[model samples]
Each structure stands twice: as structure tokens, then as C-alpha cells.
Target: MSTIVALSTPPGSGALSVVRLSGTNALKILKRLTSTLDFTPRTATLTKLHHPDSNDLIDEVIVTFFEAPHSLTGEDVVEISCHGSPSVVRQVIDASRNLGATLAGPGEFSLRALSNGKMNLAQAEAIRDLIAARTETAAKQAARQATGELSKRLAEFKTRLLDVIVVLESAVEFVEDDLPPTQTNQIKEWLLFVLSGVGALAESYQSGHLLRDGIQVAITGKPNVGKSSLFNSLMERDRAIVTAVPGTTRDTLSETIDVGGIPVVLTDTAGLRQTTDDVESLGIERAYRALNEADVVLLVVDGSVNADWHEAGLNSFDHKTQVVVNKIDLVQYGHSDLPQGILVSAKTGEGLDDLRAAILGAFRGSAIQADGLLVTNARHHEHLQQAKIEIKEALVALDEHRSEEMILAPLHNALRYLGEITGETTTEAILSQIFATFCIGK
Candidate 1:
């Protein structure tokens, strides 16, 4: 492969920027730029770099070298730390390109690492998850996966499956050499064990997806029901413009907050009320849209007056709807037959904790911590489900004492499906699509 180069650091100016190079000519190009051949592997050397053509000074940089077979890409790798100017970063890349290095495509470094056996397909995806994690819980899960937690779990599943497949294949080869019923029972039992494990992982996709991509929560109510106040109270800051006038907020405003390790995309929308003004009508229309998209809707009501459920923009309440009585300070929340819902004073921060708990309660299992190998990716889930179906088919054939060919075919398919998760059997097209989601320079 040709030597590849790219800016490792983000674009624009900062304290410092990193430029990475990999492949056979990486060290050779670095030597030409610095006009020195004495860069020690794994040691940083501060030197002045010059353009190879003009021999003019480009910039003074700190360079590090990693020899082939032990580097990130299992190839010769060189990194330059230069002043963080877009101009300087671009010039450094151009200087490397002038010496026979080509710019790397998106995720080439990590992809090369996978190609060289440094990490598997699952681990490569974990690196992306770690970079895009929005909450601490999500980050911790990604970190564990990147360190081979999921790979180890999947390896155990594959081992058990192969053992069953080996027994079934042997039975197929020795025609008329009838195996004992005990061995057949053992093989069937082992297949059941593998199927149970795969099913459990498939079931965990809901919590895994919630951790990777958070849920949306929309706060809605009639005019002047302290919806904006409740939003600010939940955020613990004056993010939205709060006013006593009805329809003060003319558009939907959104912000993200962490509640019990779950990322909540909280939206404060305009009041749900009839208005002749065009702008107010548009805002009301958006409020209903937000309501429809929200995973949980908080219906705020005035505690001092009789509640009007119709004006709250709902014919009936679903499981996602939670009633919140605001302005608890303005009226005595006495024990009466009036209805039971969470009462809060958004102006004075009363019952805010319960409100948060209510939101989390809506998503009962979404606040799960990354304890073990919870399958998060949709691709992984799909493969696990397919593998499970094949295992069931194999089990059914074994129970019926049918021809061994019927059982072995599904067993082979199950093993291949499991292998696809770790990239042992993944197609080139799927690999391209996966890596394309990654940013260039990895």
C-alpha cells in the first residue's frame, strides 16, 4: 500500500495540531522533511522541517516514529506536532505529499489496524462510539467495548457453537454408524445454551440503543401554565426566556441534560392554545409536532385552578404522558378527590427531583450501566437474531432424528453469522459503509 497522510487534530487553530503518516514510506518521508535520518523509534525529536524542493524552512516540529509491525497500522508510522494554524497544518501535509505520501481517506488508519489484526470489526466501531458518546455512561460502555469485552463474549459463544457443529459433522460422515442417544442429547443441549445467550444479547439492544442515542422529552401545557419555568427548573439554568404572558415562547427551544446517566433532549415548546396571530399559530403547530415526537410528554397544569385536559392538546393520555401540576406554592395541595399527579413549584424548585424521576421512570430500563457485553449496534443485533433462528432450526432437526445433512446446514449458517459480527465473514461493501461513517484521519 502507498504511504498515507492526514491531519489528526481537528481543523482550525488551537494550541497544537497533529499530522499523521503511515505505510512503508512514512519514515522515509519524515527523514526527507527534517533532513535527518537519526529519528529514534518511539522517541520525540524536536527539529526544524524544511520543504524538500525549496529547502526553505516550513516549521519547527516535534516528530515521533513507530516502526512497522508494531505501530497502529502495523506499518511504519510518523507523527508531527506543529503549531496549530490551518495554514501550518495544510503546509505540513503538502510537504509530506511532495515526498511521495498520499492523503488518507476516512478511517484509513483504524481500518488498516483492523486489516493487520490489531483489533476486530467490533472494536473498530467502539472507537467511533467512544468519540461520539454524549454521556459519561455511554463513554464508559464504549471504552470497555474498545478494550475487547464484546469480542471475548462473542468468542465464547462461537466456541460452544463450533463444538456442537463438530459433533453433528462427524455423525454426518459416518453413515450407518449410529451414534448413541446421549451424544445427540448433549449436542442438542449445547445448542440450546448458545441460543439462550444470543437471545439475551439481542434483547438488550433497546437499552444499548438508548445509551448510544438518547431519548427526546417535550414539556407541553396550556397558556401561562409555567411550561418555560418548568423547563428552566429542570435544566437548572435560565436557558429559555420565561415570562408571565401567554405564548411568550414563539418557537420550540431544545437543550440536552443528563438525568440518571441518561441523555435527555428536553424541548420547551409554545403553549397549546387557540390564537388568531399567524406567528402564535405556527408556534402552536410546532408544539403539537414536538409532542408527537417526544418519547415522554410532560403535561403541565395550573394547580390553583380546575385542570382542563382538552386545552392540553390531547384526547387521551398514553403511557408516555405524565401529568405535572405546576405552581404548587400558589395553592394548598390538600388531600382531596381532585386527582393524583406530581405537584411542583417550578418557580421555587419544589418537586423537581420527583419530576426528573418521573421522566426516567418513563424509560424504565434505559438508565442501565455498561456492565457486560450489551449488543448496541443494529448490525450486531441483526446477526445475533439470524444466528439464533438458525440454531433453532438445527435444534428442531436434531430432535426429530432427521438426516444429519438437515442439521449440519443450519449449523454452518449459524457459525458464519456469528463470524460476520467480528469481520471474519463480513463483505467488502458492508465494510465500506461502516467506515464511511467515520471522519477522515480517524
Candidate 2:
């Protein structure tokens, strides 16, 4: 691989900046750029950077070197820690490039590490996700996966699949040589075991995705229904405009909050109402769109007013809806009549706890155990779905007493699909697509 270099830190001023270089020429290039040439590998040295062409001192920086095969990319690596000034970072990068190192592309270093067996494909993806994580829970989940929990489990499953494949192949190869017929029941049992195990992993993606991307909760209600007030209350901030006027809020405002460690995106949308004003109508249209796209809908209703089931606005939503009766302090309402709905006063903060509990209940419902492994990425979800289909096909072939050779194709396909998630069987095109989402130098 050609020597590649990039700025590892974000593009801005900070306490320190890191310029990374990897590949065969990393050590040689470092020697050419710095005055301290005799520094030991894996040791940090304070040295003066020299201009390659003029041999003049440019900056005094701390440089660290990692010998090949032990470094992040499994190649000779050099990291120069210098002042975070943009000009200083640019000068160092330019000096390295002039010394014959090519600029590193997005995720090139991590890609190199994967190519060299330092880490698997899944770990590489986890690192990327960790870097881009927007919430603490998302970061923790990515960190867990990056630490190889998922990889280790997948490896064990792969071992079991391989064992089954070996047995099946042996049965097919020796059948004509007085070999006893393969026991159909044993094979069925093995297939079921593998299928069930994989199915569990595949099903985990539902909760994983929700944790990673967060659930979108849209507040929808008629004008003057306390939608804005409830939105602010849920977010615990004055993010939305609260006014006594009916049509005060005519746009959607959004904020993210952590609810029981799960990120929830709460959107305070324009009040739903029939209005002839052009701008108000546009806002109402957007409100409907937000309601359609949301994962959960909070239908805020004024408790002081009677329920209006005949409103056409309520008919638009077909999702899991939670009816939140706001301004409950004004009424002597009890929880008995409304078993499923929650009553709260956004003004006085009355019954907000029940509202939050109900919100959490509507989404998770205490059924999803936190200890279960979850798949978070759509790509992984799709691959698992494909693998499930392949396994089912293999099972059907076995049930029909088809030849063992007929089952091998689907079995192999299933293995391949599972392998794709861990990057055991991957292509450059797919790898490029995956890594391209990362920032440069990761």
C-alpha cells in the first residue's frame, strides 16, 4: 500500500492536532521531516519539523512512531501532535505530502487496518458509528459492538454452521460407499438450531435501530390544545413558542432528549386546524407530514373540552397513538374513565410523570428486555432477512428428501449473507460505500 497521511483531528482550533501517516514509507517520511531521527518506535519525542525542500525549522511538535504490524493500520505509523492552529496543521500536512505521502481518503486508515486483519469489518463499522454517534446510548452500543461482542457471537455461530456443513458434505460424499443414510431428524434438528439462533440475532435489529436512530415523537392537536406547551415540557426546555393565541406556532420545532437512556426526537409541530390563511394551511400540511413520518404520535387534547372524535384531522394518523389530555388540573378527571390515555397539566406540571411513563410504555411497553443483543443498522437488518430466506429454502429442500447437493447452494448463500455483516465475504464496492460515510483520517 502507498503511504497515506491525513489530519486525524476535527477541522478546527483545539488544544492539540494530530496528523497521522501510515504505510511502508511512514518511518522514512518522518525521518525526512523531523530533526529527531534516532527516536525509538512507540515512543513520543519532542522534535522540530523541518521543511523538506529548504531543510528549515517549521514547528516544534511531539511525534510518536509505531513499528509495522503493531500499529493501528498494521503498518509503520507516525503521528505528529502539533498546535491546533489551522495554518500549522496545513503546513504539517503540506510538508508531509511534499515528502511523498499521499493524502488519506475518508476512512482510509481504518480500512487499511481491516485489510491487514488488525480488526474485522464489523469492528471498523462500529468505530465509524461510534465517531458519528449523536447520543450516549448510541455511543455505548457502538462501543460494545466495536469491542467484539457481536463478532465473537457471530464467530461461534459460524463455527456451528461449518460443523453442519461438514457433516452434510460427508454424508453426501460417502452415501454410495455403504455409508448409512444420513439421519433426517438429526439434520433437521441442527438446521432448526442454527435458524433459531440466527433469527434471534436478526430480530434484535428492531430495538437496535430504535436506540441508534432514536424514535421520532410528533405532537399533534387542534389549535390552542397545549401541543407547544407539552412539547416544551417533554423536552424540559423552552424550545417552542408558547402563546395563548390559537395559531401562534406555524412551524415545526424539534429537539432530542434522552428518555431512559434512549434518544427521543420530540417535534413540536404547527397546530392542526382548518384555516383559510395560506401560510397557516402550509404549516398544517407540514404538520400532517410530520405525523405520518413520526414513529410515535402524541395527540394532545385539551381536557377542559370534550373529546371530538368526529374531527377529520384524527383520521390521518394510523400509527401507535397516545392521547395526552393536557390541562387536567382544570378538571376533576380520574384515570378510571380513560384507561389507556394519560392526563397532565403542562402549565402546572401535574401528572407529567404519568405522561412520560405512558410515552415510554407506548413505545417499549416493558416487553423489550435491555439485556438482549440488538442489531442497529439497516444494512445488517436486510442481510439478516436475506439469510433467513436462504435458511428457510434449505430447510424446505431437506423436507422434500432432495439430494444433499441441492441444499448446499442455499446453505452457502446463507453463510455468505451472514458473512457480509461481519465483512468476512465483502467486495471493494461495498467496503468503499461503507467507509465513505466516515470523516477523513478515521
Candidate 3:
């Protein structure tokens, strides 16, 4: 394999910058660039870096080395830490390339690690997710996945499927001969067990996708219904313009927030009304789009104003709606006397806890488990669906007493699909697609 080199740190000035190299010749190339003789793996050695052609001192740096199969890419590796100057970084990269090291591609280090069996595909993908995570909960979940929690679960499921496949294949091979075989009932039970287990995992991707991507929440209501005020309250900042005049928010304003350990992208949309103004009309059009796409909709109603709830089309939001009665303090309304909808006063911060509780309740009431295993990647979700279909086909074949060879084909296809998740069985096209999403130098 060719020696690959790249800037391990983000492109910018910082206290320090790291340039990484990995391959069989990594140590050889490093020996030529530095005068220091005491370089060792896992130990930071202060050394002087020099330009290869001029033998001129570039900077005093720290060099660390890892022997083949012990490093990140299962090859000899070197990391040079130098002062974070753009010129210094560029010079170091140029010197390394001159010494026979090729520039590393995006995620090349992690890709090599995966290819060498140091980490599975799921863990590799998790590393990228953990780095890009925007919320505390997202980071925690991604970290857990990177640590092999998801891989371990998937491995367990694969093992069960393999056991079932072995028995089914044995039945096919011996049914024509006089060799004794397991009973049909036992076979049926095994098939059902595998099916149920895979089915549960397939179902988990729904919540997993939401956790990774965040839930879309829309704040919508009529003019001057405290929509902007409630949006600011939820965000705990003055992100939107608040005014007593109606239709102040003539466009959608969006911000992301951590709601009960879940990432929620909240959109404060314009007040819905028939208006002649072009800008307000456009905002209203966008409001409807936001409503249709949102996972949850906060229908804000003014408690200070006597609103005709029936005329406001309150039920139009259907199951996704959470009616928020804002400005309760202005109406002298108490929590005990509150109506069925959540009560809150954006002005005085009254009953906001109830509104928060309602949001949490909506999430908890769904099929998602807070601590359960989640499949966050869309690629993995698609593969799981395919595997599920294959398992169903196998089940049908078994039930119909179809030829054993026929059932094994779909069973084998199902195994291959599961293998793709961990990259045990994958094509170059799929690997390219997965690694292409990673940032360079990762």
C-alpha cells in the first residue's frame, strides 16, 4: 500500500497542528526528515524538523510513532506536532510529499483501520457521527455506538440467524436421505425467533433517525398570538423580533435546541392569516409547508383574547398538534383552572413547565426507547429493511413446505444484507459512498 499523509487537525491557526503519515515506509520517511534518533511509539519526543532538500531547520516539533498493526491504520504511523502557522503546515506537507508520501484522501485513516479489521463499519461510521454531533445527547449516543455497543448487538443477532441457517441447511441436505433431522415444529420456532429479533431492530431505525437528524418542530398560530414570544421563551433568548403589532414575524425563524436530551429544530413561523401584503403572504405559504413537515406543531393561542377555538381550525393540526395557551397571566388564569391544552404565559413565564412536560410526553409516548439500541444511519436502515424482506420470504417458503434449497437462497441473501451493515460483506461502491461523506483528515 502507498504511504498516505494528511493534516490531522482542522485547517486554521491554533496552538498546535498535527500532520499524520501511515504505511510501511512511514518510519523510513520520518528518519530522513528529522535528526533526532530517539523516536519511539506512544512517547512524545521533542525533535527538530528540517526541509529535506535544504536540510534547513523549519521548526522545533514533537514527533510520535506507532509500529505497524498497532497504529490507527494497522501500518507504521508518524504524527508531527508543530507550531500552527499556515506556512509551517504547508512546508511540512510539501516536504513529506517530496519524500514519497501521497496525500491522504477523506477519511483515509479511518477507512484503512476498518479495512484492516481493527474496527467494524458501524464503529467507523459512529466515529464520524460523534465528531459532527451538535447536541450533548447526540454526542453521547454516537460515542456509545463508536465504542461497539451497536456492533455487539448486531453481532448477537447475526449469530442467532447463522444458527437458524445451519439447521435449515442441514434439513435440506438430509431430508432425502435416511439421516434423522430436527422436527418441523422446532424449525418453525427457530425461524420465528430470528424473524422477531430482526424485526425489532428494523423498527428501531425510526427513533434512531430522529435522534441523529433532530425532530422538526413548528410554532404556528394566528396574528399576535405570542408565537414569537413563546419561541423566544423556548430558546431562552431573543432570537426573534417581538412586537405588540400583529404580523411582526413575517418570515420563518429557526433555531436548534436540546429538549429533554433530544435535539429539536424549532421553526417560529409567521402568523397564519389572509393578507394582501406580498411578504406576509409568502410567509404564510411557508408556514403551511413547515406545518406539514414538522414532527410536532405548537399551535399558540392567546389566553388574554377571547378566541373562537372552533373558528381557528385548532383541530386542523390533528395528532401532531399541542395547543399552547400563551399569556395566561394577563387573563388571571390559574393552573388548576386551566383548560385541556397546555397553559403558559410567555410574558410572566407561568405554566411553562406544563408545556415542556407536554413536549416530553409526546416523545416518550412513541415507540422509541430512550436507552434502546438505535440505528442512526440511513444506509443501515435501508439494509435492515432489505434484510427484513428477505427473512419474510424465507419464512413464507418454510411455511409453504417449499423446497429447502429455495428457502436457503433468501436466507443467504438475508445474511449478506446483515453483513453489509458491519461491512463483512460489501462492495467497493458502497464503501466509497460511506467514506465520501467524511471530512478530509478524519
Candidate 4:
């Protein structure tokens, strides 16, 4: 691959911006930028960047060099930390391009690292997850995966799988007669061990998805029922406008908050009610859509007033909906009069904790792993499922007195599926899709 260049830091005005390049020509481009030859590996040098042809001074900067095989991409890497002025950064990058460094595409840096054996596919994806993590707990989880924890675990599975494969193949090729019952029983035990481990890992994907992507929650209620007020209270800030007037919120409002290390994407939709106005009607349409898609729905109702529960759509709400009775402060009395639900005063901040707890309880099966690993990517989960299926097939073939070829066929497929998770058997098209989600310059 040719030398690739891009702005490593977020673009625009800042104290400093970093421009990174990786390829065989990275050294040449750095030399052209600074006109200094002696760039010791892993050392930072203060330098002045100048235009290549015109020799016009561009900017004073700090340059760091990471020599080949020791860098992020396992190539000669150069990083220029210059003044954050857009003009200066532009000139520096333009000068490098003139010297033969083309711009990098999304995830090109880490993709190269994976190609050069610096990291496996799982570790490379982990780096991307780390960059995009939403919460501290999510970041810690990604950090652990980035350190090859998943790859290490997968490696152990592969080793044990290979052992089973070798024994099965030997019975197919060396032993002409049918295997004795003793050896067959022992193979079953080893197969069971691998099956149990893979099955457990596959089951952890639900927890991993929640930890990584979080859950979507929709807040829906009739207008003036304190839905917006409860949205602000839940967010701990006034993100949406609150007023006594009806139809103030004619559009869906959404925000994310950290709830016990879980990122909750809370969508505050327009009040669900009949309206003649076209705009409010559209908003109500969106409210229903939000409710349909949400992992959890908060059906807020005015506690101070009484109405038919069936009219509010609360009576027919699905199991995922939580009935929240807001405005208990207005009631200002015992819960005997209020309908059966979680009573809270958006004004007094009552029952909000229980609401949050209820939101978490919706996903009781996918609790966060305190200090364990999970298959965060859906691709990984699919591969594990496929491998599990094939493993089960292999066990069935062994049990049913099937041919050695039949038993080895599914076993080989199982190995390939496992290999795909770590990129040993992954294809080019799938790799493109995986790396395409990343931002340029890694």
C-alpha cells in the first residue's frame, strides 16, 4: 500500500492538531516537510515545516517517528503535531501529498496493522470500539478486548478444537476398523468441553450488545401530562422545553444518559393525543413509531387527574411498557387514590430511581460483566453460532456411527467458522464492511 495521510486529531481550531502518515515513503515525506534527515525512531523532534518547492515556512511543529515493524501499522509512521490553525495543517498535509503521500481512507491505519500481524481482527475491531465507546464501563470493556483478551480466549478454543480434530482425523485415516467404544467415549468428552465453552461465549453476546450500544427508551404520554418534565428530571437537566401550554413539543427530542454504567438513549416524543394541526399530528405519528421501536416505553400519565386507563393507551400497553404515575406532589397524599403504578412527582423528583431501575430490569438477562469478556460484535456472535451448530453436527455424526468423512466435514467447518472470528478465514468483502465503519486516521 502507498503512504497514507490524514488528520489524526479532530479537525478545526484547537491547541494542537496531529497529522499522521504510514507507509514506506512516510520517512521521505517527513524529511521533505522538515528537511531534516536524522529522525531517530520513537523520538520527538522540534522542527519547522516548510513548503517543498517554494521553501516557504509553514509552521513550527513537533515530529515523532515510529520505525517500521514497531509502529501502529507495522510500517514507517510519521506524526506531525502542529498549531491547530486550519491554514497551517492544510499546508503541511498538502506538502506531504506533493511528496507522494495520498490521503488515507477510513480505518486504513488499523487495517494495515491487522494485515501485518500487529493485531488480529478482534483486537483491531476492539480499537474501533474503544474510540466509539459511550461510557466509562464501555471504554474499560473495549480496552480489555483491545489488549487481546478475546483473541487469547479464542486461541484456547482453537487449540482444544485442533486436538479434537487431530484425533478424529486419525481415526478416519489410520484406523481401518470402526473405533472402539473406549476411544469414542473419550472423544465425546473432549467435544463436550469445547462445545460448553463456545456455547457460553455465544450466550454472552446479549450483555455485550447492551454494554456497547445501550438501550433505546421512548417517553410517551398525552400532552400536558408532565412527560417533558419527567424527561428533564430523568436526564438531570432541562434538555426539552417545559411549559404549561399544550403542543409545546411538536417534535421528538432525544438524549443519552449514563444509568449505572448503561447508556440509555432516551427519546422524548411528542404527546400522544388527537390533534387537528398537521405538525402536531406528524409528531404524534412519530410518538407511536418511537414507542414501537423502543426497548422500553415510559407511559407517563397525570396523577392529579382521573381518566379512563383504556383511553390513554395504558391499558393495552405491552409487557415492555412501564406505567409511570407522575405529579404525585399535586396529589400530596397517600397512594390509595392513585392508579396502580409507580407514583412520582416530576416536581419533587420522586420515584425516578425506581423508573431507572425498571428500565434496567427490562434487560435482566443481559447484565454487565464485572470483569469478564463478551462478544460485542454481531459478526462475532454469528460466527460463534455457526461454529456451535457445526460442533453439534460433529458430535451427532460421532454418536450415530456416521462415516469418518461425515464427522470430519462438520469439524472442519467448525474450525473455519472459529477462524473467521479471528480473521484467519475471513474474506475481503467482509473485511471491507468491517473497516468501513471506522473513521479515517484511526
Model 2 clashing residue pairs (backbone): none
lDDT of 1 by residue, 325-374 (tens): 88888886573533467888998998999998898788776546556667
lDDT order of candidates, top first: 4, 1, 3, 2
What residue pairs clash in candidate 1, if any at all?
none
**After superposition on all CA atoms, what RMSD does each candidate show versus the true structure?**
2.4, 3.1, 3.4, 1.7
Per-prediction tally of clashes = 0, 0, 0, 0
lDDT of 4 by residue, 1-442 (tens): 7999999988889999999999999998888777788999999999999999999999999999999999999999999999999988888888899999999999989999999999999999999999988888888989999999988888888887888778778877776788889988887888888899889889988888887888999988888999999999998999999999998989889898988887899999898777799999999988888888898988888888876544667555577888789998888667798888788888889888988888898898776564578888888999999989999999999889898788889888988998998899999998999999999988
lDDT of 2 at 369: 37
Please identify model 3 stretches exceeding 4 Å from their true place.
51-59, 83-91, 98-100, 168-175, 178-186, 243-251, 273-288, 307-319, 333-340, 363-365
Quality of model 2 by C-alpha lDDT:
0.83
User: Estimated TM-score per prediction?
Assistant: 0.92, 0.88, 0.85, 0.96
lDDT of 3 by residue, 289-319 (tens): 8998988899888887667644555476778
TM-score, ranked from best to worst: 4, 1, 2, 3
- Runs in model 2 deviating more than 4 A are 50-60, 178-186, 274-281, 304-312, 330-340, 364-366
Instruction: Output the number of the TM-score-best candidate.
Output: 4
Kindly provide the TM-score of model 4 when superposed on the true structure, using C-alpha atoms: 0.96
